[model samples]
Target: MTTATETLLPGTDIVLEQLPKVSLHDHLDGGLRPQTIIDLAAGIGLELPASTAEELGAWFAEKSNSGSLVEYLKTFDITTAVMQTAEGLRRVAHEFVLDLAADGVIWGEIRWAPEQHQQKGLSLDEAVEAVQAGLDDGVAEARADGRTIRVGQLISAMRHADRGLEIAELAVRHRHAGVVGFDIAGAEAGFPAGRMRDAFDHLAQSFFPATVHAGEADGLDSIRGALLDGRALRLGHGVRLAEDIEISTENGTSYARLGELAEWIKDRRICLETSPSSNLQTGAIAQWGDEMVDHPLDLFYQLGFLVTVNTDNRLMSGTTLSRELALVSDAFGYDLDDVLTLQLNAASAAFLSVDDRETLTDAIIAGFEPFLDAEDAR
Candidate 1:
């Protein structure tokens, strides 16, 4: 490991790296260590922007912060290039979990498109097995290190491609292995969830959980597809759903009106996995404004939508779940209790059984007790 001036953490005094958190939207390819990328690139005869890991890391941060999602995504070409082989896939997944554990993630759902990793001629089953092996090793390592961390694969299909149905079947087939859910990612605007109806249908028949990427690059129609056609249980970066909510004040009183889609999401308690900084960088919330305060997260949270803060991509976004929470708290004036509430929301929305969800919720509640008490005393 490179010696750095400071550790990435929430706070210096409180052992921020030890705080309990759950990550739902983290991506396996997006969280790879820059060193790994550099070495893997060298091994694969791939050229990189920088030779040193820190410089390469800086390059990614600079390039990603360009306020263009397309530019931000270009960085992933380097990562996915190296993840095609079994060793690369397994090591990347293993390291991804270890990094999450270091960032204090108690649980995470790592989503990556398997279709993108078939460059090395690995079959779908082979790719899944590689990632599963990595996840298993990571979990064992976490346990041995005195931290019980869990990770599940949210098998993702590319919306811009025609392999959704096949990927959905792949996820269902590997449900007992390490896969936990299904999702459609990549090219959100023109490629609505309806484009992958067959995949969603297959997943629905299998009773699998889906979380669609909507309301980020596209507007309400995309979200509608995710809900109606995709039957998504959760929304990935559904921050733009706030567009349907009308805000007004009359005679010093404030009220809000929710459109049909927003009403359904709220009434149904559908989880909105909001990533603050990443959204701003990717222009997902550009229509709202450039500032975090302009984000509708506070509005949705107050409106009773299941709002769970997440780090969409740790390396790409250069953020952790704790940092996301800290950023949200800074932008939305959330206290420790509010942080706990977000964790509780995530635990409830996890794609686990009712009993497991309840158990997870209780664990979250127990872990957050000190924060709750600290906030109460203040």
Candidate 2:
């Protein structure tokens, strides 16, 4: 597998890892370094399926490719198990930021369920604080190494569980700390965002931001629930929103007709946090096809919907933000301009103040300007 630093844009001298990027939908429990998992599991007296980092990484990748979201989610059992304690969470959180910085991600949101990590006796607040401490350490370390990166926590409530209200409060409580937003994940089919109406209402009243995992495991109704019930600012893995678009070709020309929901999402520029590899693995895009090229990301982008590329789980997908961008570029014949547009979309959709978002946008544009100019001169 190619590391982010080694992956280059197709037919270009530009390295993908050198490009400034933003990640809005990454999962914390899903991004542990394989070696860290082995060490943490050993300290916790837990037995792992694979003894070596390479083998363990392979195990996650193999299991995640099961083509079922439920089955794909099973791999998190091992990862979350090792992260039950404050120490484990801290180490994993620290390493996660460093890895993101290494991959040239300037800003990212790491989402995870605190309720799941309470198995080791850490309170939800304690767990959030531990992760924040580690994030702070990672930021300091990266700065010491001359790399600039910023990250925030997106507290998640398991959709299958009933802690939505509790988790929403937890996120709001930590808003001034490291928590930036709220989310609901796990088993998205039957459990619509409407189930967590009270949580969303609380967040709305508190003026907190949220991003709902929708249009991946379910259809348009799920997306509707996300917008109307969850009041999400962004759609996690909203790739399946393509279903609402009717496509037809006429005399060698193609046209796309948007449904009401699609038109609203498009007109409003609600960010679609699309993960190409993870979407394929979870069979989220199976209805369309099983290949990266078949992903409706291009279609959505062509239609002017706010689309941002992400790696839902770095370890499970054995991918980086850079790798995801490279794959999409290869699939859709995208250039630096497309890459810049995607980063800008993510920057605009981030749960930050308008001023902060503008700063991030300026940084991304500046990073891409040199290469874009070079491309223009070519």
Clashing pairs in 2: none
On a 0 to 1 TM-score scale, where does candidate 2 land against the true structure? 0.98
Candidate 1 lDDT for residue 263: 95
Candidate 1: tens digits of C-alpha lDDT, residues 151-177? 899999998899999999999999999
Predicted structure with the largest lDDT when compared to the true one: 2
Q: Evaluated with TM-score, which candidate comes out highest?
A: 2
* Residue 354 lDDT, candidate 1, scale 0-100: 96
For candidate 2, write residues 275-359 as lDDT tens digits: 9999999999999999999999999999899999999999999999999998999999998899999999999999999999999
